[model samples]
Target chain A: MSQNNLTSVVVGNRASISKPRLGLARKRAIIRFLFILPTLIFLAAMFVFPIIYNMIMSLENYTTISIATGNAPFVGLQNYIQLFQMPLMSQATWNTLEFVIGSILFQVIIGMAMALFFKRDFPFSTFLRTLILLPWLLPLIVTGTIFKWIFDQSHGVLNYILMQLHIIHAPIGWLISPNMALISVIITNIWVGIPFDMVLFHSGLQQIPDELYEASSLDGANRWQQFIHVTIPLLRPVLAIVLMLALIYTLKVFDIIQVMTGGGPANTSQILSTWSYTLSFQDMSFGQGAAVGNIMIVISLFFSYFYLRFTKES
Target chain B: MPRQGLRRSHLTIIGALIVCVMLFPVYWTVTSSLETNTQIFATHPYLITPQFDWQTYRIALQTQLPHLVSSLIIATGTTVLCVLVATPAAYAISHLQFKKVTWLIVALLISQMIPSVSLDNALFIIFNKIGLLNNYFGLMLTDCTFSIPFNILILRAFMQSIPKDILEAAYVDGAGDLRTFIQIILPVSKSVLITAGLFAFLFAWGDFLFSVTMITQNSFQPITVSIYGYISQYSQSWNQMMASAVLASIPAAVLLILSQRYITAGMTSGSVKG
Candidate 1:
């Protein structure tokens, strides 16, 4: 949307052509700069400054005691070294990988399915499509909390339904079990994510011309073949964006997992974000938490570079 | 025609089932909110409320009203701040030329990738030093880190589409940049502005990271943090917890239904995400 060529047709010219006087135009330019100055300053204070601060904190021996005593002595790489050697950091690293991958793969697949299903001309499909987006709109905290209820060991709706269906003979503690905690959060994330992916994919699906499908069908192509050859190929642009964003956001999964499991059952489910919080607030190891946070940022920046590349390409 | 009608029913059934499965949590939330704690915890918890009880909600309101009000203030503050800062920046980016607009855009995009943990990790120190801890204004300021750029991008996308002729017309009438923006540009871009504002509000309202990290004081916390505390503190209080969840969802559900087109527009805009 920002790259619309038509958007620049006037303004880039108006700044020069509209004003004849150089001094007056210069004055106008100053005023225009003033408009955006606040945002620039705010972003700097909020993100840029804090990001730099995080780097500094990661190197220093900042902690709860540091806040009180104001004696955060500079420690070169001890925080990083100690955190690396800790068992929690290793577990969090693997868990973060699983959480990100598990979420994006499932959500995109399920979301595309939902999107394709809704694209059909069916009774109340439009209404139901909107209804399906409720999870995405609700707060992550709300989603995680209620899901914690639904995934409860004995009283959970999930276990109850599975047991009733004879799929499981006994109740499973979704959040209590360390391995299941990761799986449970992934499942909840997929539910929250499906609507977003579906919405994006649904729009992408809408843009595919009907003639292509009809032509394929006429060329002796089955529905499945048409989907594989035409639909998947054409939806590449949306797919790229959806995948990039899902990866970026899933990497930052904190509130949901924090509320759902708090990386519980002996720290089995701790991801980098939750681990960072645990280190800083729970453990009072602010320096280690900052180090973990820097690691997360590095991971995000790595993906964001690709995201920017893809956005630029398309 | 009858065959087509039959096919539609089959599709409708599928669609309805999907809706039920996807929305079961929301439905269960409302139902569970209206049931007693005993009924909610019992084996084979009533799928539907046997009695439309208001006791839990009454209790929830007693505890959560202040938290809700606090959340409202913070979210509102964030939205207002976001729009105020973003509109001009978006306008400048779209209408005014900078030395390196692409650089600025890239910078903003990269800023989005800075995880909340890093920001909170540092902001805790900064806020603590500056005496902003447990402060409403501090939380609002932190939440703006999210909404500002999101609104800027969304608004810039819309503002860029506003025809040059409109601004040219305002200029021909001898109106200045500020006047033209206030008189011509703003009224024309009202819907997008509203969309931007709505999503900003939702972002701040749904915020848990900043809420939990910044404001630890019990008297001044949002529903998200409060509900999180409730879940662990009173693990058996499913009825009250669900009631609070329902309360937390009221705004999203209301906005989802009432502003369907705006919600759809905002969703596609990639305003808020994972």
Candidate 2:
């Protein structure tokens, strides 16, 4: 349904407004405007104001000390230049790409597999599908806490299981060893992301007719061929939506990382979100934090353009 | 037919197994919370809680009760405010012709793209000046930034499908706009309202970014921030730490069970509208 398309026609609703009297319609319109006024003011105050304020803050040399002094003088681009100069900036950029891409890759693949498997309507399939959503529904802090212990260097459940399975001789430092820190967080994200992708994918899959599968098989298409040809092509719209939404979700993923590692061990696992937080809160450097935050906004806006476009087209 | 039936049963077994593995961590959270310190810190932590213990949970509850109450207040306040503000707007935009609808929609989408960290940064500055630091009202306002837009959209979607004749009949009955909304639209739209309210409550309840950014004082933190502290302070007491995490997740679990369909429907309609 194009109902999801916000810019779609409002023919039915618009009709009600068509034939009201000039004076009464004016009155009605004013009332309706009044209805939306609360939301308008709220958005302007909470959202638009903060965005502009963040931009202004990014240009200044604001810090905690400035809080007491009341002296956050504007230093144009100084914060951005400082951001670029930091060695952590480049590492975080690379880490964000790896984390987002890695998490999306596995989440989609594994999620797609689960969605396909669950398409075979069996007993308790619906309940099972819903049950799998616990990970997605749980508080991020809980997930992070659980995974931290599971990924502990010594005496961790994951390591114990690996050794028991003879998969490895020694316990792997999943959250330690800066090299694997990002990967560990990515793994935790994938686990959390799978159910979301699966639910959406399954919804998309349900829209495809069983007749198409039957027809494809009758035309000598094998199961693998049907999936590659019929299923994949039909799922393009969903694929685009899922990928974009996942991108947004991954970009906003500050809680789990903050809870799990706090971008620790010399900031090895710091992505832009966590790094912005560290600069703003922990180090009390508001300018650098807002600068990092603005960079992420730029990135989000770029992808959001394409995302809204795809949503419009579909 | 017999072979197909056999395989279907086998698939059931496999599905159950997949669930077991997928949910092991959640299972571990509960079991670990119940286990003693010795049981948890072992080379191989027990997969099951053999000896039940409520002491850790008691200790966690003692420490985290205020935070829980704070989370409840914020979440409930967000739900109340989001519905109160967003409903009238959603009803107006969906039922009436507003030229500003498109702009509002864009703002909603763009607001979603603006990272919470930036809002946290800016809000921190504003809150510092306004003395809203560690304030429930400020935190509720910030949390509703996400909730209000989604509530408006989801509620509007449902309101749009509500057959105009139902509203037109109310208009014919000499009922005013406010009266019509209160009498007819509100009654018929109960499910959507509940769904939206639940989503709002959960979003605020589980919120960490805003809670952590806005509220610095440990005593006034939400259960989320409290549990984050619980992790560090009780690092040795894994039971209490994990128990606190479990305590924090109660709202999510309860709501998920109580309103699974509404939860999923809200989720999809908020994004990929059906």
Winning candidate number (TM-score): 1
Give me the runs in candidate 1 sitting further than 4 Å from their true place: A1-20, B1-6, B271-274
Q: For model 2, how does the per-residue alpha-carbon lDDT over A40-158 read when each residue is reduced to its tens digit?
A: 99999998898899999899999987788867999999999988998999999998999999999999999999999888878888888888888998888888999988888886788
Cand. 2 Cα-lDDT: 0.86
TM-score of chain A of each: 0.95, 0.93
DockQ of 1: 0.64
lDDT of 1 by residue, A1-314 (tens): 55445546556566657567888887887898899889889988998889898898999999778999877999999999998888877788998989889999999999999998899987788899998888998999999989999999978888988998999999999999876989999999998999989999998899899999888877888778988999999999889889988888888879999998898888878889999998999999899899999999999999999888878776
Clashing pairs in 1: none
Docking category of candidate 1: medium
Residue A101 displacement in candidate 1 (angstroms): 1.0
- TM accuracy, model 1: 0.96
Cα deviation in Å at residue A198, candidate 1? 0.6
> Lowest-scoring 10 consecutive residues by lDDT in candidate 2 chain B?
B1-10
Off by over 4 Å in 2: A1-22, B1-6
